[model samples]
Target: MTASASQGASSISSSSIKRDASEMNNMVTMTTRLDANATVRGRRRPPLSRRQRGNLSTLLSRRSPFSNETGSLAIGEFEPSAAPSVDGVARSSLRDARILVVGAGGLGCEILKDLAMCDGIFVDIVVMDLDTIDVTNLNRQFLFRSKDVGDSKAAVAAKFINQRCPWMNVVPYHGKIQDKDASFYRQFKVVISGLDNVEARSITSENPIPTLLLPNRWLNGMINNLVEFDDDGDPLPETIIPLIDGGTEGFSGQSRLILPRITSCFECSLDAFAPSAAVPLCTIAETPRIPEHCIAYAYVLQWPREFPDRKLDADSSGDMKWVYERALERAEKFGIGGVTYMLTLGVVKNIIPAVASTNAIVSAVCVNEAMKALSFCSQSLNTYMMYMGSEGIYSHTFVYEQKQNCPVCTTTTHHMSVSSIMTLNSLLQQLCDGEFRLKAPSVTSSMKTLYMRKPVALEKVTRVNLDKPLKDLMTSGEELVVTDPVFPDTSLRLVVKFTDVDE
Candidate 1:
């Protein structure tokens, strides 16, 4: 293929590849794990010693994921064995590479392991986590043990990896990722996030995390805002950091390769996450339909009334138990079943049990993409991959396009022509019911806040502005900063250009 054609081919996202359960029956499989009494290659394999078991090089020497005897790399046949003429040089580069992992939970542990075990591809790893290991984390977060509970997750995870791979250096940061500045993040070659929260993942975009995959030509307009210039005035490719983000929920998971301003960012895809379902307060209080309604009632009404001074900490075991008990009482009263602790936690915290298998699959894909990004051993995912293991092993890879008016990545302003007589309510409706489809947007201008949707006191204060005309709020052509729950960290800029309308 020609240069342009090759670029196009590499960039195009592939259709969904389904590996049905029935298909596994037809394929021949080899069992790599030796039975305690089993022989391998016509010889009895001795039991591994503690030191030997911990040593990763002993296992990696037998087989590496990127290279096969046929000189083919799995998944698209991008041959790593062929790509690097001098294996020593490539391996050296990989050994010296530094990668930052932004979680030490289920997905984080798996990501760190996968990246570290990649046969000299990554030796310097930095893992960060604000949480301490809870007993609940032991089931899926394989790196932590029951004894390790109440200890810093990042420290324990690092110690575990370092003990196994003596040659590798794993640095642990036992603090919030927000505490670290750009200088701290810029040291790493790649930033791989195994974080569960969207806000933290979005914050990674603001940090030194890089974006790769998209060509500079297509993203010229957007990159100009983010890309740094070299001494010669050319855009510095080194300044563009690549972020490999992966998340798992239950039996489903996804991994994305992002290039911040140069490609589809985490903020650009915020619309994909459906907004939280709003239940009417009356239904929650007077009549309850499902078990979740009871939980909500207990959380929303009972908690605050009982403990006026204290705020509910969802992570607190005491708080969760109290809520669970109250919710259970409410459920029993309303003749509702299935109001268990797990369900209560889900309803209150809005989190599901992290599946170990799903985390492994997604983390492996994410680390693979990171390796490909650094080594160029294969084409990186262009630029999202979704894995569904609920039924069968199914995957869908697609290129997520960037939003033109993306509040985070782009400064593209929106223009709205409205009559001076238009009420603030009409403008709010236009934002919600119109093309923007914004939910509970708060409108503000350079002068004052025309309306606020949150903070009961402020909402009450600004409530009268709803029926006020645009003329009373501000002059025509005034710039308005429209904030919504959709874009949590940033606001949309809408220029209200006046237009004549006869009443």
Candidate 2:
């Protein structure tokens, strides 16, 4: 067969080969025309053009997504565009939807990239993270590079999305969630979490936006969205929306998702992480704690501050020096080590990345599930966990099997009549008061306040230590009394006297 005939046959058989052949024909035609006069003049052959060189490079460098050189699939290789068809309806639901992600860390960046690049469904994304990039996040967090260390993760991620897919909107929030209240939450049709902690997650989950939550509940609960006038003329929705619940637990991280009435509230989900007898000492040592000199801690412990602000110089050399100095000062003031030892040990281990990544993954899962719920497409109320380790990706789902005699979930107490503001104030007052106690098995008493919320009590409360007054054991009120609690050996106790009732 003629060369042209053979080329035509091969091109017709393969679409990619046909495209290449057409381009090659144009190149050959141009070269022949240019060399026509040169050949007549007996001139030397011309050098290869830059365009031809690039074509050669593309042909030679073509690689499969499964290539060992690339640990991950090349962009767009793994994403499925169309959902599985069932009864002529598409199962993949996110089509031309706007999704707002609260953090651009490990999970946010990955989800944004994947959804934006997927072929079948079009997605618009907005990413918000108050954190600037750090060098320590280079491991499992894939969106960043070495040069992006000082840049804002949110902004950098937005720029990346813009460059890769200008069609998608990847907005960034360089500030905290508290900076963006209801107005911010209402802007997006769906909100996704890439947050780091329970506090942030609670804000996104609990925000009462009609667009997200109302529609979500209406759809998921299979209720008609109609308003009804009651006997007293109070208008109410015809149906109450159910909550969505999800959770994830892994060796590196744990996450819980509560969607209004579907699962538990954010507070209710705390039961999964509630202090149990199975919790170990090392795990307890890792929880974030307030410094002993914290005014709140002093108030709770009823002691006066004897040390300056427990700030550390970034240039300090010893791993434990910053902690040791803080601990020693706290020990002197409170007559106990307080959380200084845990803080010091955490510094030594530098588990910030692990915690941060764990948080990031949990946030991502929570956000994705939230979007699913808001889009009226959620499936289950189980907790989803993502385990990233040498053993590979392992996910587990859990459901709250309501106990017949459970104290927290099954109680018959009346719904509190307080407004949202009053409820929050009451919780805060209770926390500050000596009566409604707060404690975390993982954190010292000084850190207990961090975990105080109406939702936390729904989970079993493991009493780490009983409140003991230093005045009871001291011989004289004039002398400073310090002693360690047998329970939380990491903390110290102190008592101070005030003659005036206000003091």
Candidate 3:
């Protein structure tokens, strides 16, 4: 049957009253008599039976779940009599689930609102954010206002949900989650990422907790769902993976739900750019460097030198240089514009609110997918990408089959061996500590070793070993170069290149 037809049929079935024509007529008569009489006289009111009282209560107390003043029980507190049959898996899935949101930004605000208002799912939300409301955030973040500036986002968001649905217990954590330990994070059944940095993403992904990483890209967005299994236990395999498609690239957005394990995990969708792929620092504007001119201009124009008390002694001159350098570094790191010498260069445009709104919508799609996963109604199993432009919306869904020799998943039994998993974990820890190094060789023979300080960006290219043969060096795929030198004593820096590898 068509979905709309089936929905209409269900509605009709649910709304069908069990009362017969005589019972309905009696109810109407009673209602008319009650409306006409200022006080009941002639006959005494009939005592209502338990069943009759229940029917009357059901009719009179039926309130919309989204209503603010509704006396309906809060989520997670449904009465046993109202619970669905235990035999139905779909109804059982959402009975009691704890959802932890790690940010109170634009995306977090929208997801919280939707989860609170939308029916069919029972969710207990815990909001965590270290930031307070800023005037700049008022443009796209919906839950905050000018008056809310400097107020805790988590607290404000929680109050917003409580006012809408008092039954919901929206807990707010007004502290940074970066320093939170794994034990502290275990309270959540699922973790949703609404953060804006690679460090936070990596930390959340590595967490043993089931985590959903929703990062917005230039045009398309990515959702990474990481599921960790118990050491000796196996649960039911994921059945329906919905292919998620849609995101605002230029103007509009599109989304599809994909089932993983049954279809493809975010990593299997693309041979190279998996959902866990690290975004380049340039993409997120984390490693912005100030222009030399800006540094020089700041020093020459803004440096205080006229006041006798503020005279530039040797120490003061060094401090001024340090301040100028620090300011330049910050400007570059945050991708902000450098200090301009000319004030009349025209006003710099702010990041568009529409763009931020688009991001929020895209993030909402990820949250929706999580809700579907929790509610046990996922359908599609493929990678879905959406192209939202000023002109129109375009979407594409592709099923990614596991490569027979996939180093990460395929050749090794679909499950990582304990030792291998431990090794990978160690490597990740090293990467996190900034002790590990990633190198990519350049096309030119002179620029062989590119020392990557951080995994997110290609920073400096230094020639460490000039005498080594370029072709004989061991390499992985064209995009990745692995160096395991045979001679331990020899200080030979190996060369690797970043080349695209076919799946």
Candidate 4:
């Protein structure tokens, strides 16, 4: 061999030696752990009986076997007859409980597995996801496999879980969460979401209108929309269900429990979620600094101009390739680097990188909260938990306060004072640009429709109202029911007070 070839062979040999040494160390650690586990197993207490395990009080009273105390049970006995029952009808167990899980992704898969395996109870579950499985999903979405690509994520995940736990019934809904109405949501005692998208979590039919005035996106609009209120401004008991939400990005994640009207809902803590970063058009079109800038340029400027009649579907391989090529060309021209197909897809689709470990941690917390909410075995996370593994393993559980003037939870009517001379278009603009940050909202008075953005015919009729003054539409102190596409089933009651001044 040549001198350089011999040197390369020596380097490979060194690397192989190091790899072998590392493997040996790992084996030693594993063997040590196994030996310790065997010793502990020898002294392990017998498994608790089904009756004792299902009893919340009994489970709580059981002390740890590893404790220095003499006995494992507080009373040193099992009372089968004392097991809790549901009003003398049936046993108080989660086996009969129905749960709805939305988004059969990474966190969803872990949640389903954990819930099915939890306490050996096979709780009936409903899993929903509109997305189809992709090869990319197999890495973290453990329920799917290479062969399962191109199948519905919800269906595949449900099938896997059902096969693994035959007693557990997992029904899959292969459609958008928005497709389901309030009646469908009322069937579940708890709703757990492992969705990555904010809009999907909120189940918004359309994107919130973009505005610089609001820095945060809409909160769990799904709960607000699903919940119904009585005449006294109290939530209908049947409509209120605990929502356990989990989200993960990189090494960080959070799990939050929302109780409609009672505790803070998703929208109550809107400021916590940072809005998607918006790159200035000037930067994208003129001075490209990063790969994202190039991607945006291709998506925002080039895509429409090139394909005027065809919409750019982010999920379409053809469309994504076209955009990627264009972005590559732009990056090359501007001497920019790091423009990959994945990066382009992420930029166009607005996807965050999901970590499996983070998903698992957050989903476990979510399912635990759900159990607590339903079984009353322990106090529910009061009502938020945050996890950060980027620095070190860190977790915090705390209460998220409810907003008094929240547009969704409370019946507090927002007072909007406008000049009589202000045109309907100006009022609409204010609603879009003001603190409310509503997009494409339809306005209705007590008897007539002032303006509507849908039902093509109705929108055409109300188009003329845009130029009409507020005074011409309604009187002072007239209440207007404002509904936005972002919040389909919920309406914001805005009491419009017309004043003579330009204020």
Compare the candidates by TM-score and give the number of the best one. 4
lDDT of 4 by residue, 1-503 (tens): 99999999999999999999999999999997876675444774455688776644454334333222232111112222243443221223556678999889888999999888765443589999888987567789999988898899999999998898886789999987767777777788888888763421111113222332121123256666667789987778667788888888889898987877788876667556554444556667899888888888887789889999988887688999999999999999999999999988776765568888898889889888776666544455767788999979899988789988878667689998889989989998898656665768889999799999889999999999989998899988889999885564778899998778443
Q: How close is candidate 2 to the true structure, as a TM-score?
A: 0.42
Q: State model 1's lDDT.
A: 0.72
Q: On a 0 to 1 TM-score scale, where does candidate 4 land against the true structure?
A: 0.75
Q: Order of candidates by lDDT, top first?
A: 4, 1, 3, 2
Candidate 2 CA-lDDT value: 0.42
Best by lDDT: 4
* Better-scoring candidate (TM-score), 1 or 4: 4
TM-score of each: 0.66, 0.42, 0.43, 0.75
Compose the digit string of candidate 2's lDDT tens values, residues 1-503.
Answer: 99999998887789877789999999999998877766535876676676545331222233334332232211112222232332112223444455666667676676676556544243467777777776556665677888998799999988888787876667677875544443445444444554432211111122211121212221221211122347975434222222222222223554444332223333333343422122222222333133423222222122224434444332234524544664555545544435554444333322233443454455556544544343323333254444554355655656544433221222222111222222222333433232212232222222233222234562224221223232222222232211111111122122223332232
lDDT of 1 by residue, 364-453 (tens): 899887876675555567788988898798999898998888765677898999999999999999987665656578989999988998
How do these models rank on TM-score, best leading?
4, 1, 3, 2
Better of 1 and 2 by lDDT: 1
The per-residue C-alpha lDDT of model 2 at residue 244 equals 26
Q: Between 1 and 3, whose lDDT is larger?
A: 1
Q: What range of 10 consecutive residues in model 4 has the weakest lDDT sum?
A: 200-209
lDDT of each: 0.72, 0.42, 0.44, 0.75
Candidate 1 error regions (>4 Å): 1-87, 197-226, 229-235, 303-322, 418-473, 480-493, 499-503
